[model samples]
Target: MIPKHTVDRLSNRLTHLKPILSFEIVFIAVFVTLVFFTGGAAAQAPVGGGGGNTSGWETILDNLYNVLYITLQYAGLTILVLGFIVWLSARNNSQRSETGMKLTMGGAAMVVAYFGLGALVSLLEFIAG
Candidate 1:
């Protein structure tokens, strides 16, 4: 049997942690995996050749795509984390209603959109080749 004082302390600590524990865990896990695997290497370039006189529009699109991809990569992780926090809040409180579910779904949608856009870009590149 645990001591009463110890149990009280543990309960208090857990109560305080209830709001953000899920987000923290997800963020830490993603961060650790990325750090261990990638180790700060830059993104790989798309497989293609410049092939004389790339238009201004093409250059602009390429730069925009690169920026969007990088931004989505980081932002997706953050949304995943925020979704977790919202999930925890919903779980702990009955008043939260469907907001947490919406957040989680929205986060998932952004991740999917990021990948979908990447695939679309790749398809366009393939056609151009």
Candidate 2:
């Protein structure tokens, strides 16, 4: 369980961040709702040499996939390493050890989430199909 102070601190932070967070939430929510409600049938892309439908999509997908995979994996690794260092450097401090442990777990979660996203996409495709 999280401590009361941490919960209160996070609540305060979230309160301060409300406007920006609301804007981001609304921005994504509108598009996401449109996506979910708009597509009614499976559409096939045409094959062509000059600016084909799949060309732009393929490039965008490739770039996005590469960026996410590289960034997530490296960021997770960096966090995990930092957490390990923190854990070892503060071996005598129980609070620091706990913080380090949480950070390490969060890093591991991020890595797992990166790997899991592919499977999640497959699952979504199956369900949507």
In model 2, the runs with Cα more than 4 Å from the true position are 1-52, 121-129
In terms of TM-score, which candidate is strongest?
1
User: Model 2 Cα displacement at 40 (Å)?
Assistant: 31
Which pairs of residues collide in model 2?
none
Summing lDDT over every window of 10 consecutive residues in candidate 1, give the lowest-scoring window.
40-49
Kindly list the per-residue Cα lDDT of model 1 for residues 84-112, writing each as its tens digit: 78778776675553676667777788898
RMSD of each: 9.2, 11.2
Cα lDDT of candidate 2 equals 0.82
Worst 10 residues of 2 by lDDT: 40-49
- 1-129: candidate 2 lDDT, tens digit per residue: 999999999998888864656777999999999789867433444446455456666776878787898898899988988888887888689999988988889888888987898788789879999
Each prediction's TM-score versus the true structure: 0.50, 0.49
